[model samples]
Target: MNGETLQLEIKDNIACITLNCPETLNALSMRSLIDFHASLKQVIASHEVRALLITGTGRGFSSGVDLTAPRPGLNPDDPDELLRDYFAPTYQLLKDLRIPTVAAVNGVCAGAGVSLALSCDIVLAARSAYFVQAFVNLGLVPDTGASWLVTQAVGSARATGLMLLGEKLAAETAADWGLIWKCVDDDKLMQEASAIVNKLAVGPTTTYSLIKRLMRDAKNNSLRDQILLENECQSLARKTEDNAEARKAFAEKRKPVYNGR
Candidate 1:
C-alpha cells in the first residue's frame, strides 16, 4: 500500500513501513494515521510477512499529532471522541499483530510520536534520538496509549516525571531506564533494526507470537494461570513441524529449515 503520508515495502518476509511526511517531521497527520492502519492491515494479512519494522524517512521519527493541521469538525468540548476514532484502530492493530514489530527511531520522538514508538514490540533508537512527552507543555495529557506504554516500560515514577516535566530523554538514557531495547549510532539504526527483524523472521514464529501474548497478559494473570498458559503454549509448540525439524537437525548436526508450521 502507498499513500501521500506513508511508504510500505516488503522484502524477504519482512515489511518496512515508513512515516513519510518528513517535511512536518512526520507528525501524526490524519492521513498518515489512516495510511498507517491500511499498511498494517495489509501486513497482518500477509502470511509470508514474518516480521515488520517501522521508522520515519527524515530527521525525526515523529513530532506527534500535528496541531497545525485541520481535524474533524468536533465540538471543542468533545475533541476526545474525534481523536479516539482516528487513533484507536491503528493502535489496537499494532498491539494485535501476531508477528514481531520493531520501531527504528532515527531521531526525535515526541508526544504521540512517543506513543507510536512505544507501540512496537521492540524499539531501537538512534544514539542521537530523543523521546519527549510534549503533551503537558501544550496543556494536554498523554494519549494514544502513551501513558500505559510509558509506564509499562519505565514504571510510574519515570513516566510521571516525563509527562509532568515535559522533558526529553536521550535514547541512551531511555535504554538505561528500560524504555527502549537499544540505542545504536544514527547511521546504524536501520541496519541494526533490520538485523533484528531478520533474526526474528527466521525463528519460531508461533512461539514468538505465544510469548508475546503471554508477556502482554502476564501482569493480569496469577502465577498458576501463567504456568497453565505456558504449558499449553509449549505443548502446542512441540507439535509444530519446526520443533521436530529442529530436534532432528540437532541430532544430525545439520541446519534446520523451518516451514513456519
Candidate 2:
C-alpha cells in the first residue's frame, strides 16, 4: 500500500486510515483507490486489529473520484465490468471487513465519499461537515453503493431529493434525518472518534463481528429468518473466548479483559 495518498497506522488494536491527498480534497485517483484497498486488506488480515477508523486529512474527507483522472466510462470498456473489477471490490471489502468499522467525516463528504462513510458500521461527522450526493450535478449517477446506502439510511423520498438536487446536507441536518449516527463539534471530531474506536478495540469483537453481519442482513431478512440467524449467532458467540472471559470476570467480580477473541 502506498502511504503517500493513504496514511495508515495501527495502535491499541485499532487501525486508523486517512485519505492523504488534501490538495485534491483526498479525491480517489485510480492508484489511490488501489492502494486503499491494499491497506484495508492488510488491516483485515491482521489478528491485532479489532476495529477500524477511516477519515481524511485537511478540509474534506474526499470530493469523490478525481474527475480529471482517466475513468472507466470514458473508454469503450463495459461500465459494469469496470465497476465489478475496480470499484466493487473495494466496497465489498469494506462491507465484509468483519470488524467494527467507523467513519469520521471531518469535512466535506460528497459523491462516492458519501458511500465510503455510509459503508462503515457507524458514521460520525463534524458539525461543520456536510454530505452531498453531487452526482446529478456532474451528470453522472451515484456509484460505489451510494444509491443503496443512502436509500436505506434515509427513505426513498429523501434519497430522491439528495440524488436529484445534489444539495449539501449539513452534518447536523444529516443526523436529524438519520443519515449519520451523530455530529460532534468540529474540533472534537477526532477526539470523539478516537474515544469511540478505542472502546470498540477492546470490546467483545467476535460478538461485534456477528452483530455487524446480522445488521447488514437484517433489512433483507424475514422476521423468522432473522430470529433463527440470531439464535445461531448467539450460539456461536457463547463459544468464543471473550464470552468465557466475561463469565469468569463476572464470577470473580472483576472487569473483563477482552483480547478481541
Candidate 3:
C-alpha cells in the first residue's frame, strides 16, 4: 500500500519502506505514522518478504514528531497521551517484526528519529549524517524507547551525557560508540544498505529471526539463560529447509541457495 507520507515497495525478497515527507525532513506526522503502520502490516503479512529496510527520501531520516502539526486526536500537551496513542503502537510494531531490519540513515537523525534508527536490527548512516538527542533542549525526556536503546548501545554514562547535553553526534562518532553498525559515505548509503538487505533477504531467514529475538532479549538474560535460549533456537533452526540446504552446499563445496524457509 502507498500513501502520501510513506512509500512501501517489495521486491527480491526485500521490503523497502521509505519515509516520503521530505518537506519536514520526514517528520512523523500522525498521517505518516498511520501510513507507516499500514505499510508494516502489509510487510508482516507477506511470506515472501525476507528482510526489511527503512530510510527516508531527503536530507534527513526523520526529525521526529512534527511539533507544529498535531493530529486531530493526539494531545502534545500530554506526553503520556501522545506516547500511548501515537508512538507506542508504531514503535512496538517495528520492534516486533520477525525479520531482519536495516535502517539506512541518509542525513540528520534527531529526537524520536534517533529512536527509530536504533529500533532496527542494523543501522547504517551516511558519514555526513548526525544524530541529535534534542529532547532535553525542548524540556522533554526521550521517548519511543530512546533512553533504553541509547543506554544499551553506549552505556548509561554516554546515554546520560547525550540525553542531558542534547548535542549533535556525528555518524562516525556514533559508529565508533557502537550506536550504529557502520558509517559509509553519503553517496554509498543506499548502495551499502541495499547490499546488506539483499544478502539478509536471501540468507537463512529462520536463523536471522532467531538471532534478532535472541539479541533483543540478551540484555535481560544471563549467560546461563542465553545459552539455554540459544540451544532452543538452534533446535528450531535446524528444522528449517534453509539449514538443510546450507549443510548440503557445504558438503558439495557450493554456495548455499536459500529459499527463506
**Alpha-carbon lDDT, every model:** 0.89, 0.90, 0.91
Q: Between 1 and 2, whose TM-score is larger?
A: 1
Per-residue lDDT of candidate 1, residues 15-109 (tens digit): 99999988989999777887898999899888889999999988999999998876656467876764687788788889888888999998989
Alpha-carbon runs more than 4 Å astray in model 2: 70-82
Please give, for residues 1-261, the per-residue lDDT of candidate 3 as tens digits: 579898899998999999988989998877887888889999999988999999999899999878876577766587576667768898889988888999999998999899998989999999999999999999998888999999999999999999999999999999999999999999999999999999999999888989988998799999999999999999999999999999999999999999888
Find the 10 residues in a row with the least total lDDT in model 3.
74-83
Q: Return the clash pairs for model 1, or none.
A: none
- Arrange candidates, best lDDT first: 3, 2, 1
Give the lDDT of residue 61 in candidate 2.
95
TM-score of each: 0.96, 0.95, 0.97
> How many steric overlaps are in each model, in order?
0, 0, 0
Tens-place lDDT per residue, model 2, 1-261, is 348589889887999999998999988777677778889989988889999999999999988878676664435556465456767899789889889999999999999899989999999999999999999998999988999999999999999999999999999999999999999999999999999999999999999999997998899999999999999999999999999999999999999998777
Clashes of 3: 0
Clashes of 2: 0
